[model samples]
Target: MSTPANTITENPPPISTGVTPQRLSTLRRWNIGLTILHLGQAAAMLILANNFAIPVLSAYTAGRPGTIGLTTSNLFDLRIGWAIALFLGLAGLDHFLTASFGRRIYERDLTHGINRFRWLEYSISATIMVIVISMYWGIVTINALIAIAGANVAMILFGWLQEKMNPPGRTITTMLPFWFGALVGLTPWIAMAVNISLLKDENLPASLYIILIVQGVFFFCFGLNQWLQYRQVGPWRNYAFGEKTYLVLSLAAKSLLAWQIFAVSLFS
Candidate 1:
């Protein structure tokens, strides 16, 4: 009788490159999900901010003859909510798009260090930070342009950071972008707290309260998701700084958002 052919097959060698197909797919899915979630948030907030608050402010100004016309203070308060919502929306989209790019980079297994993508990350993070700061400082001239630039920068950075941190079989890099993204995303919310004293209107207070609550929910989910991803990828030696930073900032952001909502509700 002919000898039976061995049924066993040899195992394939490990990939000696940045990231793997499985991990890349997971990251892509995460990025896409984050993008969708943020986009949903942006759309919802836009509706509320524009449809509800703007109209209320308009009516308050037009209907009440003697009421101080939309004061600088009122405008500022309204804009604060608008800016936060807008930032969240843009950041969400940025994360999704950048992660997509990162996936491409990882797939190609580029030889350069993460620095290759640093410009992209820095551009996005810096631009977003600038727009947020400008809005806070009341620099309206290039706010829209800045917002767009920030979004683009953030997406590029997402890709760059992903490539830098998550080289194949590595867990540290995978979580880094999520953590950084959370921190960067939280900056606007933190800045908004400075103006909490300015939102004096009755309706505006209630609306803002709701928005803050929504923000909290958003970040809470984001943090939890990142943690889960970390669990899946196992451990690494990088400074846990990113995770710690994300948690702290996320909690702070949630707290501020909650406090504002509570403060607003008290008046209502």
Candidate 2:
């Protein structure tokens, strides 16, 4: 019996690539393109880093603010652009290595659910981003910085667990891990917000407000990609679609953050 033309199934069969040659070829091309893009961005950022550096709190003594506990290396002096470069560079390396050697695993396409390389990269790169932003927001107390880094790392681990614990082909995605991950991720942002409100008594720069808005929106989009995938929203219903969205989000988010930061703080 033929189904009606307008009818659509609520849950379609998984679009796992099944290791087909054509699908692999397509994925290969994607990886290659992402490799070029990320590496190119990294190179450009390094060039910018050559001329610009952001002062970051490196070490501070607890006893006093001025002369009592003096130290030479109190601040980390380096271009945030360099850190952003690392973020892009790591992404490039992930793609390059996967395209060159991990062809077999690329076929997993969300059936296995977990992309370990992605979480691994996030563990370093994303954590760096959080720490950088936290410092930028004047949340530079040693304990706060450590907590921020730990929270971001935990968030990434929870993300890995989300996939590891719920391979789509083997079980219905419980989604608890995803929510837990979101909660963990929110911690750093909340800390940043609270710090800002408490610390900034005077008028804040307009650019800073813009930066906050852009960062918040892009971060939401990042989480939304995962939400859509699990909710089986259109396009996101395809795991590959969510993967592509993640790539795009990573590029856009990092680019925006890097250049905005450069323009506002580093361009001398």
Candidate 3:
């Protein structure tokens, strides 16, 4: 049979790890939907930032305790909602760009069995969370705050490597990188816990505990998602399943954090 002129018969190349056009379409829709959700949440948080935002304190210590040139550290207070907004919006931007540019933006990520933008978002958002926790526990020294952020960012990057170095068809038999990342990620949380404990739980805000529990649970879920993906457990055998799970996790984590903060700082 002779082909008709200008007939579209050839299939477009898949984006990211040989994802089919159908899968790519599904992913694009998923990105669009999640982007809307993230942006919506971010907008709400931003609006609330003006009056309901939580206090985030930053300090600069002039010298070590009891040392010469020691000066009273000046604390700078910032709004927490703004941080939340940025966190949510960064992820929204990731999804927005992914959906908008489709293949061009997501090709590398999908090809590598990872989302670089996701890790990048986490690097910022998760760092913010850690910083908030640190300040809440009075770990406000500039050096300590920087270390916390650096550790969190490093952990997130290691997570990126966890996927980038072990894509599908590569026979990924171990998840050492993920475990190591988790270990590294534990620093800030553990430090927070120690600080809380040392303070003897005297007059601490109940919201602080709530934040810890909620964040801890979601952090575990994030690790579980990656582990399931690596082990190819059940539905996770499909890369798209893992991807979808990640999207859900991201949304749930951000939403829970935002609402929890809102409940304490705004609605209360």
Which one is best on lDDT? 3
RMSD for each of the candidates: 12.6, 7.9, 6.0
Q: Write the per-residue lDDT of candidate 3 for residues 1-268, one digit (tens) a residue.
A: 9999989897543333436567778888898998999999999987765554334334444667665553444565557777778888888988898888645668556755777777887889878876865766778767778889998998888889898778666743568889899999888888888888789656768987888788888878888898888887888877777787888888888888888877776555
Sort by lDDT, top down from the best: 3, 2, 1
Error of 2 at 116 (Å): 1.1
Find the candidate with the highest TM-score and give its number. Answer: 3
Ranking by TM-score: 3, 2, 1
- What TM value does model 2 have? 0.81
Candidate 3 regions exceeding 4 Å error are 1-18, 50-70
**Which residue segments of model 1 deviate by more than 4 Å?**
1-18, 50-78, 99-102, 106-234, 238-268
Give per-candidate clash totals: 7, 0, 2
**TM-scores for every predicted model:** 0.37, 0.81, 0.83
Per-residue error (Å), model 3, residue 167: 2.4
